[model samples]
Target chain A: MNIGSLLGAIGQGFIWGIMTLGIYITYKILNVSDLTVDGSFATGGAVFAVTALSNIHPTICLFIAMFVGGICGLVTGILHTKFKIPAILAGILTQLGLYSVNLRILGDKANISVAPVSTNITFLANVLNIPHTRAGMLLGIIISIMCILLLYFLLGTEFGASIRATGNNEKMIRALGVNTDNIKLFGIILSNMLIGLSGALLVQMNKYADVGMGKGAIVYGLASIVIGEVFFRRFSNFGIKLMSSVFGCIVFFIIRAFVISLGLKANDMQLLSATIVVIALAMPIFKENINIRKVGKINSLNEMKQVSSSDEIVKEKIEKREVTEVGGGNNA
Target chain B: MLKLKNIYKTFNSGTINEKRALDDINLVLNDGDFVTVIGGNGAGKSTLQNVISGTIMPDFGTVEINGINITKYPEHKRAKYIGRVFQDPMLGTASDMWIEENLALAIKRGENRSAFKWMIDNNNSLFFKEQVAKLGLGLEDRLKTKVKLLSGGQRQAITLLMSTLKKPDLLMLDEHTAALDPKTASLVLNLTDEIVKTSNITTLMITHNMRDALNYGNRLIMMDQGRIIFDVAGDEKKKLTVEDLLQKFNTTKDAPSDAMILG
Candidate 1:
């Protein structure tokens, strides 16, 4: 990719990478495949557009967008945790419902361009008076670093620990006297809040928000997470994992930019992203199945040793019985 | 400190698979009462613990802990008063969390957990290392290691430590050592006894092993078909022999096949 295009791709990646952090909470930590991002992303953009049209501060609009997105997640969380709905279906339902909600926020219009811009165009450009192209790159880096730091600290706190524990073992957390439903609700809320903030940033960068802005957003998020995990699989520290996930986002966007330059059509983008996510998701399961084909897929050497020792004991007993019994050779 | 009054529960009610899991069960545990429960598969031993822990609510009964009606409370709410370890080592502790982190979570049992304070504070971490050191499994030095990397015995020990950290009003162990090897199982059972003795926590343990049932607790209870068939304690329980228990177990034709093999 050309230098300018590559920088632009990185900028776009940083915005989506913020959303990827949200997905990390639901997908990796909370262990819930929240499909709400497809809708929550648009909800964020819609809220930002509506609030900005009313002459609100851009930063305030970002908070409003996140608040709206968090509500969407709260709906999904309640449905899954309390109303007895399956998690995926609950997220799907919220996502589907947000279609009309997003439309309403957009004043029943499909698109709202930030023309004759109400406030200075980009966050970095407005605040730092930097060139537009450089501002884009700078904005991405700043937001990403901010999110990584916040998440690292949050996940270290008691509430965050319980939330992670809730994702890790629901029964264990509940046994430890944590009201797990509340913890899950908070996790979903926090995750979608970041996703909404990312959406707001995307709208500012593109200078327009569309009703279909969130289409395939979940695929991208998952792709970013998978890519990040593939590269940082060995880093167990929470901050490193978050930073790598954002790094994954930047790489994913840059690669997409390069492929587009190679004549990939806009209509084909969704299909390509979907395929990438499917492959990433299936790789681990495929590995397990391959292992299962080999002697019951013993996970560790300790188990293998146990199995072999049991076999040796049986062999020794048969030999001992042969020596003690007459005509044992005929029986064998 | 714990009471189950006429607890009745049924699964798949009105269906061909309908079976009564708890049949008007009544139980009372005094503070520091360490009771061992023995039963065959599907004998409702697990169902009893589940009811107490609020994982399963009795269809028609009241559960009271320390004079409060807890039958209507949710499972998480009841956790404030109850500690539990499952047969599967994975169930009692978060595998992804560190060994010390697991204990940190445990120490907060029955307390507000939504605070924003640092989870692994120096005070808590030091306390965890010291408490784990007492297990004598060399886990004290590996506080940062994830619980998943530990052996089954180690995981069970950590889980046990977690359950008893703050001394729950009642501790329930549902075949906690059944998944471990014989030697490991014995080791965990011994550790369990030590913890119970030192903490003086009220405990209810269900074991498929009849010998363990008779040997570990201050009281022993036998169950068949969702009913407490025999209860013994103190001098009377001490005089009982394994052969007598096995003979008694075999008299019931539907007794667990494995119970007959008990020594």
Candidate 2:
């Protein structure tokens, strides 16, 4: 790939990498398929774009977008935990609701493009004396790296262990005196906050936010997690998993770029992403079956050992009997 | 002490499949009381334990632990005062977690703080090792091993240790040894008896083995349908035999199911 193309792909990958962290929290840590990601992404973009357009500081706008996204996640958590709705359906319901909320945040427009010179990227580029695209790329990398570090620290905290425990075994955690419902709410909110931040960053990078930007976002996140786990098998630690997810997102984008270079159509990208996720999830199951077959072979070996040992004992007993019979005959 | 007064629990309350799981259950357990519960299938043994542990809300009743009415407390809330062991070895502890990690969580049960850091003090580890060492299963040296690698009986033994570590006011055992082989089951049972006697904690255990019911506890309770049909304690419980239990089972209006009898 050309240098410019490579930089562009890497920049986009960084943004998705942050989003993948959010996805990892919900999908891997909480073990919940949170479909609210799509709408929450748009929600972040819309909130950030509108707020920034109104002369708010970009940082403030970013925080606002994250807060909005967290609220969306909270709603999903409440619906699932309190109302007893299925988790997947709860996510779908929230995603659908956010569609209209996002539109309202964007003044009913499907797209919001900031003035070219006044856009967040241009403002940063002018301040730093760099090209807007390069500035955007640098900004994406910094934000993604910061997110990964913060998440890594959080997951190591006592509350984080409880959250991980909640996903790993809710019953055990509950029996340990943790109110897992609260933990679920906390996890979902945190996940969507990261997702929203990713959207906010994406809009600044592209100089515009569109309602359709979040489509297939969940699939992208899942694909990144799967790819990261596959690539980084030795890092089973929680921190490593977080970092791998970020790397997975970056790798995914680079792969996409390569696919484009190979003359693949843009329409086929989603198809390829879905296929990758399916294959990645099936890897462990496939590995397990192979391991089971190996175990069967080892078990047969153990059986043989037992058989030989028993035969030796029997032979020893028979020899003793022969000795006793010879002694009795000699005495006679 | 723990008390249950006139507790009633019915499943599928208005439908044709409605079944009474617990009926007018009344019992009083003093401090350090170790009681073994025995019944055929659907005899409300587990249901009674669930009710006391706050896993299920009784349709009508009162439960008091140490003179505190906990009838309305949620399951997680009641966990502070009650420790439980399930029949499935995998249910009581996280299989993927290290043995010490699981113990750490249990040790901190009912504490308000989170247990994120693995920087357990040497003193704490020494204490834990002492507790685990009591099982005589060599688990003190295997504290870092993931619990999933342990055998069912070993896991159950570890779970028993973990549960008694906190010395909750009431300990509930729900057929905890039913899943093991005979040898392993006896091993776990021996550990259970030792832990209960040494801790002097009030405990209620459910077991399908009639002999185990007669042998383990100072008191033995037999349930039929949703209510206790017989409760024998002290010297009388020690003198009871499997034949005596079989006679008691026959006299109850609700016949014991085949699974309960065979089990």
Candidate 3:
């Protein structure tokens, strides 16, 4: 990739990093494979576009988007916890419902584009007088760092400890006097809030919000997390694990940029990303299976060698006994 | 103090699989009473504890702790007054968590968990180290180690420590040492004796081992077919022999099983 393209990829990666962080909470901390991101991400963008059109401050629109995204999470949480719906199904239900919600927020439009001279432009670009791409990159770095610190602090608290414990062992945490349902709800809400914020930032960066903006978003988030884990597997520090998501996202976007330059169609990228995630997730299991087969082969070979050696010893002993019998007969 | 009055539970009601787990069960435990429960399989020993701990609600009963009716309380809500360790060591702890983190959760068992308050601080870390040192397993320095890495015996010991850390109103041990080897089981039993004596906490322990049921607690009760057939305490309990108990069992029901006699 050229220098400019690489920089652009990094910038987009940072913005997506916020979404990855949200996925991390549900996927890692809450131990729930929440599929609400695709809907919540678009909800965020839709909220941002509608509010910005009404002349709300662009920065304030970010928080508004987050609030709306969190509502989307609340719906999923209630469905999963209270209505007894399976987690994945609950998330799918929300994602499905958000389709019409997003359209309504966009005034029945399929997409909405920010004018080139509109105030919907991000504060970093306006205040710093920098190029749009550079502003996004800087903003992403600043916001991601702030998010990392906040999460680090939050996870260290008593409530955060219970959330982690709930993810680790639901029964144990419940037995310890924690209402696991409440903790799960809080986790889902917080996760989607961050995802919503990421969506708002992306809408501002691309200067447009489309109804299908968040298609395949969950796979992207999972890929970022899986790739991040491969890099930070050895580190038990919570902060380092969170940072790995951003780094992974940056690498993922860089790879995408390079593949696009190689003449790959954008339509084919979804299949490619899904395949990458599947391979990454299955890597450890594959290694374990291979090791087990190797050990099994060696063990069987050893058993066969022992059986053959013992047979030879028994035959040699019988031969010696026969010779002794013949020699004794001659003495007689 | 704990009370279970008129407790009745029937599993698979009205079906061929229907079985009465607890039938008209009534139990009352005074403060600091350590009661050892002994019974064979399907004898309602575990069902009684489960009823008290809110794992399953009785079809008909009023469960009370210190005069407060908790029959309708959920398991997590009842946990404010109850502490439990399961037969399976894995059920008692979050294996992936650090030793200190687990202990921190235990220490706040009945307290409000604040969002902004730090779970582990320097002061609490030192306290946890001291508490772990008392286990005498050389685990004081390994506070950062995950609980999954510990042996079954070690995990049970930690679980025991956690259950009693907050001085819960009632402690329930459902065959806590049944999963450990004999040596580890005896060690854990001894530790249990020491902790109960030191803290004077009210406890209910269920076990199949007759000798253990006789040896450790202040009182002993035998259950058969969802009923407490025999209850003994004070000098009568202290002076009773294994032979006397077996003879009592022979008269009350069938002859004692070989496992019960050997135990």
State the DockQ of every prediction.
0.47, 0.31, 0.54
lDDT (Cα, tens digit) per residue for candidate 3, span B31-126: 998999987778888889888888889999899999999999999998899989899998888888899999999999968998899999999999
TM-score of each: 0.90, 0.88, 0.92
Candidate achieving the largest DockQ: 3
Sort the candidates on lDDT, descending order.
Answer: 3, 1, 2
lDDT scores in order: 0.85, 0.85, 0.87
Residue-level error in angstroms, candidate 1, position A77: 1.5
Q: Which is the better candidate, 2 or 3, if ranked by DockQ? A: 3
Tens-digit lDDT track of model 2 for B113-132:
54346425577778889888
Interface RMSD of each: 5.8, 8.2, 9.1
What DockQ does candidate 3 score?
A: 0.54
B239 in model 3: Cα distance from truth in Å? 2.5
Range of the 10 consecutive residues with the lowest summed lDDT in candidate 1 chain A:
A293-302
Best by lDDT: 3
lDDT of 1 by residue, B1-263 (tens): 99889989999999999998888888888999999998777878988988888888789999999999999998888888898989999898899899988888888886886556888888888899899999999989999998888888999999999999988899999999989999999999999999999999999999988788878988888877777877888888888877777777777656566643643
Better of 1 and 2 by TM-score: 1
